[model samples]
Target: MTFALVRVRRGDLRLDLESFARYAGVHPDLVRRLVALGLLEPVRERGEWWFGADQLAELARIERLRRGCDLNYAAIGLVLDLLDRIAELEAELRTVRRSRPPTGGAPWTRTDSR
Candidate 1:
């Protein structure tokens, strides 16, 4: 995850569909397609969909995966899921490592002579 910074207008944490598309530099129809494909989740309010500012990061991630890996939406979804799982596992491993006492030498040591 390299530096990806998104600037949003202050005091506007939610964006309408069109605004969301514009901010992402894409067409609204593409946004709709993403929504249909379950890649983007928007909240329905008053029959209109609103997306959180945080979704910009998700959109960027989707584009990165699509371009970098040349993947379709469905494959992108699977890749994102796997990436998330890997991150979770890494965090868990860090936590476990921190909780355990360090061995005097390597983690694996033979206690029985051959």
Candidate 2:
């Protein structure tokens, strides 16, 4: 799929590309490559790329995938996309649970008599 996985955190301040790379503990060149690869999207402002403060989490996630799983950029992109989908599904499940009326009895009782 050629889908772009983007998650902008609400109320986060923006930083220029260099500043973002510094804060993310990665080289600016690496960030640029990731952006170009469609793995990350930063705003272009006055010849500079601007990123959200929330991208810190994303940077860390990318690093984690690289280090822990030894995944390349392409694989990281797919894994992150799947992770985002899982998060969205969990949020929807929580909303559905909240909207449902509470039952007097428990959801279910465990049966271990056997």
Best by TM-score: 1
Misplaced by over 4 Å in model 1 are 1-12, 108-114
lDDT of each prediction vs. the true structure? 0.83, 0.79
**What's model 2's TM-score?**
0.75
Give each model's clash number.
0, 0
Candidate 2 residue-wise lDDT at 22 = 74
Tens digits of per-residue lDDT, candidate 2, 6-110, equal: 344666577777777777778989998899778888887568677875576778888899999999999999999999999999999999989988755564663
Candidate 2 lDDT for residue 60 = 84
- TM-score versus the correct structure, for each prediction: 0.80, 0.75
